[model samples]
Target: MQMKKVKIDSDRCKGCQLCINVCPKGCLKLSNTVNAAGFQYAIYENESKCTSCGFCFLVCPDVAIEVSRKAKPRVEE
Candidate 1:
């Protein structure tokens, strides 16, 4: 099975919430603690529910989000 991963650049985020709104899986959310720029940056909260659809990346204006999938290696007997 392949697992999806999301990476958000907190420093670059402006708390626009565009990515959070576009996420189909509801995997992203605004952090309670603000970033250095004093904005509540988006963070990936739900790892199991994410489908790696790249919707968040497409919507983020600041280019702060990255989505990737990692496949587990198969073990041969």
Candidate 2:
């Protein structure tokens, strides 16, 4: 099973699409809805395609994106 998550801080995001351009999996997109700061925020569009590579987090100028991988469960014999 693939386990990955991406989160965006809407309040801090400046509506720059830099992160969206850098994502290799194309899992992110700009939302039509505006944030409290009046900026259209980035969203993780397809969680199934996320690879937790952190590319979005690195490219985000406002430092708004976060990506994490869930630890796999151990199988004991």
The top-ranked prediction according to lDDT is: 1
lDDT for model 2, please: 0.86
With candidate 2 superimposed using the best TM-score fit, by how many Å does residue 12's alpha carbon deviate from the native?
0.9
**lDDT by residue (tens digit), candidate 1, 1-77:** 55349989999999999888988889888899999989999988879898888998998899998889767699999
Q: Alpha-carbon error at 62 in model 2, in Å? A: 1.0
Q: Which ten residues in a row have the lowest lDDT in candidate 2?
A: 1-10
Work out candidate 2's RMSD over C-alphas: 3.3
Show how many residue pairs clash in every candidate, following the order shown.
0, 0
Each candidate structure's TM-score, on Cα atoms with residue i matched to residue i, is 0.83, 0.83
TM-score of 2: 0.83
- In candidate 2, what are the lDDT values of residues 1-77, reduced to their tens digit? 55349878888987899998999999988899999989998877888788799999988889887778877899898
Query: What would the C-alpha RMSD of candidate 1 be, to one decimal place?
Result: 4.0
